[model samples]
Target: MPIVSTSTSAFYERARASMKDLRSQAETLQAQLGSGEKLTRASDDPVAAARLRTLSRLESLSSIDTTNADRANADLSLADSAISNMATTIIRAQELATQAASSTLTDQQRAGIGAELDQIHDDLISLANSRDSNGHALFGGESAGNAYSVDASGNAVYIGTNSTGDLPIGDGQTVARSITGPQIFSFTDASGNTTDVMATVKALSDALKGGSTDPAGAAADALESLKQGIDTLTTGQTVVGTRLAWLDVVSERRSTLTELRTTEEASLGGTDIASTVAQLQQTLTVLEASQASFTKLSGLSLFDNLR
Candidate 1:
């Protein structure tokens, strides 16, 4: 026979490669067991990783939207409360004006009513300049500071902008978060009548203090003006109530959408714990068997047999 070659390196190399592969699998399984997860890195499953990333981004956006909705809701609630208070104040003023309009009332009685009306006017002005959670004027439109200011003659002057800022509620939608004082309290009547409530109060106060004996006619006119003002404020309150109800509806819808998004995210990226645990156990068994076989082969070389 031809000369027999005693080289068994191929067998040793193949055995070493098998051992290396087994060790790598065992290490991966150990990591999975420790972390209670199947994938240690994105490279392990790129498709799942990408889906998880998308879900995470969407969750972040949802959180931001929720915050915006909360702010918008707060603004609307403030507006509602303000309007309600203003309506009550207007009604009180109407009552006072009616009392002053009676011909039987003396100048002294009208003066008392005028003083009270002045106080109510001041209260209304304070409400118009009320601040929100952000310390910005609630009825100031887009202006952050005080909405109404007093002139040299003690007349109420509007210092705010004309446009109410809109707050985004997501899905390409936005809501007007506030109404300006001018929008609610200042207007000209259908009969070409121009008046501001504060101005009316000032005029009544001047007439009363002047001790005019002919106060009944002026007071009568003020009573009609007070009625018109009350009607205007009531309309504003109605608008605010409608806006609050609409916000509630949108909030509920957003909550439902958020729940759906959470479920979708879980389905796309969540791990299967039972399957991952079973795979880890199998890998451990294979690794142990491979190590035992490698040890036996390492101890038994052809040279040992010769000995």
Candidate 2:
């Protein structure tokens, strides 16, 4: 009789412990539903939790890459706009040079054209030293100073460093944010003479100011130099356009990858509300049944049987 009673008591103790476990599990499910996240602790699903950690880190890095890519794209756009403005200014200078080339124009008219060219030269210099979003020179490269500055003799000098600027837009990927001052504004002429657009325009302006031996030849040379300058600017624009297109492609790729990561994260660590609620209901039902059975068994006392 003693042995039978001890066995019965052990069974009831196990039943009570199981009921407590069911209630704890139900509470965990409720918390999961409230938070909208499963695997709240690493112990919930160790392998899934590890994978989620990695994906979370990657998502963070991808966000930074997207921001950098956007910034680079904006900077490139600004550079392109500035280059277009420079081209327009050059076209106006060319027009003035065309009028000055004519033999019919008087000294007074030529001087007035030169004066305008002077202003244009100054304008080009200002444009070359244009600031970017951060107030640094757009074409400054790594240099903190202006991309181009006038020396004592008044010739514009390239003061910036090489390799404009490169930004890491993604994992193992980078893009140049700008072009250098010399790439767009300076080039060699048809006669193998080294000249920048500004220098050529300035030279033409000086020649037109003075009574040269042959203003016609000088004007022709200036015209050729101006054409070369336009070509240089056009080439630079093409390069910038290509980079902008590349940025677009890369941005799309990054965005798609981010979406994929989110989906994977959801599968690995997110909750299923319906499934969790059903599980909680089942656990509660079992807990209630165990409690009722335990109470009935506990009420059937040996002394009540004897009575």
Please report the candidate that would top lDDT against the real structure. 2
Instruction: Give Cα-based local distance difference scores for all models.
Output: 0.78, 0.88
* TM-score of model 1 vs. true structure: 0.81
Tens digit of lDDT per residue, candidate 1, span 154-186?
A: 888999999888887777788888788877887
Colliding residue pairs in candidate 2: none
C-alpha lDDT of candidate 2 relative to the true structure:
0.88
Weakest lDDT window of 10 consecutive positions for candidate 1: 264-273
- Candidate 2 deviates by what RMSD? 2.2
Q: In model 2, how large is the Cα lDDT of residue 254? A: 91
TM-score of each: 0.81, 0.91
Top candidate when judged by TM-score against the true structure: 2
Error of 2 at 296 (Å): 4.1
